[model samples]
Target: MLKGKRILVAGAGGLLGCKLCADVLSAGALVVAADINLAAMDERLQQHGIASDDARVARVSLDLSDSSSVEQFFCSLTDLDGAVNCTYPRNKRYGAKFQDVTLADFNENVSLHLGSSFLFMQQCAKYFISNQRPFSLVNISSIYGVVAPKFEIYENTPMTMPVEYAAIKSALLHLSKYVASFMSDSRFRSNCVSPGGIKDGQPEEFLQNYRSYCLGKGMLDISDVVGSIIFLLSDHARYINGQNIVIDDGFIL
Candidate 1:
């Protein structure tokens, strides 16, 4: 679907990010794997059998939190067709429970994740406007952003869906819409993909609880979420803008 495209996969060191690079590469796009840790991102890509010197892969370091870094990276680009932001930025105390979360930590986490998202989205739009080229940007949100958390599912688990995450992701959906509208050109579009809980070694009890709310697939794998992203980035979705595609196996239903 993305043949001949040059796509940027931010946060390429992450599990989802790395897998996304491989998937898009298989679809024939030149994958620019970016992360704050260049070495780590390269290592992760290698784990997925993407050679460091792969002809279709280019690895770069990106720290979304730094304005200069983001600007420099985007300015350095010449023909970026699309980008998927899979970066999940957080401080050390990011996942604390609601009650345990201090106001300081809350602000910091929000600034780290949401602020960086704003920066990246703004840069993408600016790049398109300046170059007058067609561009697609896919921001990764979450099912929790669409609906309230199923607190029951996380009961026995040590996870409580961090309050910061809820705030950041929910805001991101609206942010994408805002950018899409602000851009106002069909060729320059922004969209979002909100995936349900992705399996990442959570306890079975929690998985069972999660499954009860889903339609068969208890939790998604990284692969399950990439197709929608690839579609949004492809010309197949040329007219699709400011839309949110939920891939949660009916979890929010």
Candidate 2:
């Protein structure tokens, strides 16, 4: 669906990010695998079947938190079709308990992740606008952003939804809406995908509680999100904009 296209996959070393890169490459788009850590970028590319000399794949170190870096990165690209941002920036102790949340951590996360996300989106919009081209941007949000977190699901688990994540993701949906409508003027498209809990190694008790809330399976895998992302970035979805497509397996219902 994305043949001959040039797509940038930010946070390409991450779990969802790597999966998205593989899928985009399979769809025949030139992927710029971008992440902060260059040391791991090559390994991530190799894991996704991209070789060092592969013309279709380019590796770049991106500090999404840096505005100058963001601008320079976008400025360097040419014939860019679109981008997918799956970057999740957080401090060292990210998963803080709800009551244990601190203002310092909250502000740092919000400013770092949320602020960087805005700069990324805005920079992409600016690039497309200057080039007078049509492009699509997909921002990864969360199901928690769509609905309040179910504290019951995390009852026996060692997890509680962090306040900063909720704040950043929920606002991201609105930010996509704003970028799609307020930035482009019909030339650029901005959309969001809000995914539910992707199973890693959560306890059975948490998984069971989570399943009870789902219409189908309990949690999602990388494959579940890749297809939706490809469709959104493809020309077939050219008409889709200012939309938040939720992929939570009915967890929100």
Candidate 3:
């Protein structure tokens, strides 16, 4: 869906990010796969059979936490059609149970994730305004952002939905809308994709618990969310702005 377009996949080393890079490249977009870990990002791309010298894809390093790095990255770009922010920055204590979360940890995690998202959105909007081109910015959110967590699903597992995650993601959806509205331009679009639990080696018990709430698939594979993202990046969704597309089967129902 994204042929001939130049799309940037930040956090390209990550699970969803890597898959996104490969799929978009497959669809003929010139993919700029970027992450702080350049080597790892390259490795992930290779794992998907995308060579470093592919010409259609470029691997670069980007640290979303640093303002100068983000500014320089945007400044260096030209003719960029779309970008996705998949970077999940968090402190060491990120996944602590709700009751076990410290105030400091909560504040820091929020700052790292949500704060960086704000910076990214700001830079993307600036890029659209300066270049005077159509640009789409996709923010990865979670189903937890749209609905309260089902604590029962994690009953026997070591996971409890982190308080900080809920705060970050829910805010991201609104922030995307805020940027789109602030831009007030049909050319600049900002949207979100909120996916349910992606299978990442969670206990079978937890998986079964999760499946009970879904209509069909229990947990989505990383690939399940890619098509929607690519759609948002392409002209097919040119009029779809400031909307949150949830890919959670029927979990939220």
Candidate 4:
């Protein structure tokens, strides 16, 4: 469905990013995989058995936190049809009270999730407006953005969940909506995908616990997010704009 399209995927080194890249390539789209860790991405590509000779894939080193880096990356693109913002902070600690969260943690999360996305969206919108080309953006958000997760999980782990992560994600959602409204006159669409706890490479016990808590909540592989992403990027979602699609196997219900 994405034939002839050029798509840029942020966070291409991570688990979900890898799966999304493969899916977009399989759909006949040209992909530019951008990540901060180029070596990690190369290793992942090799592990996944995707050949370097594949014409559909390209890799670029991108540091989203740096404005200059973000500008340089987007400036190098000649034609961009769509972008997927899957970039996230490296930590996965999911339990902490808001009062216990540090200022550094809050700033870091905002920089990675909200600030970087805002810069990219601004640049892309400018490109679309100036070039008069239609484009789409798919921002990846967490279910925690909509509703808080159980804090009990953090009690056993070394990681501490900060309320800032959730706050930044919610901010990203609003950012998407604001961008969508700003581009309402143009052929640009911005939306969000909020997925429930994805079970990519998680331990059996953790998965089991999550599954038990979220009974009837179908476990989603990274591949499950690809279809929704593809739909959002394609002309098929031409009329869909400023909407947040939650993919959590009905867990939110």
Q: For candidate 3, what is the lDDT?
A: 0.93
How high is each candidate's TM-score? 0.99, 0.97, 0.99, 0.90
lDDT value, residue 20 of candidate 1: 94
Clash count, one per candidate: 0, 0, 0, 1
lDDT of 2 by residue, 79-172 (tens): 9989999888888978898688788888898998999999999999989978877788999999988988889888877888898888899999
Error of 2 at 166 (Å): 0.9
Q: Name the regions of candidate 4 deviating beyond 4 angstroms.
A: 90-99, 152-160, 201-205, 213-218
Q: Candidate 3's error at 41, in angstroms?
A: 0.8
Candidate 4 local Cα displacement, residue 134, angstroms: 1.0
User: What would the per-residue lDDT of candidate 1 be over residues 167-201, giving only the tens digit for each residue?
Assistant: 99999999999999988999998999999999999
Quickly count the clashes in candidate 4: 1
User: Judged by lDDT relative to the true structure, which candidate is superior, 2 or 3?
Assistant: 3
lDDT of each: 0.93, 0.88, 0.93, 0.80
By lDDT, the better pick of 1 and 4 is 1
98: Cα error in model 4, Å: 4.0
Best by lDDT: 1
Report the lDDT tens digits of candidate 4 across residue range 16-135: 888888888888899998889998987877666667677778889888888987877777787789999878763453334677666776676677668888998898888788777789
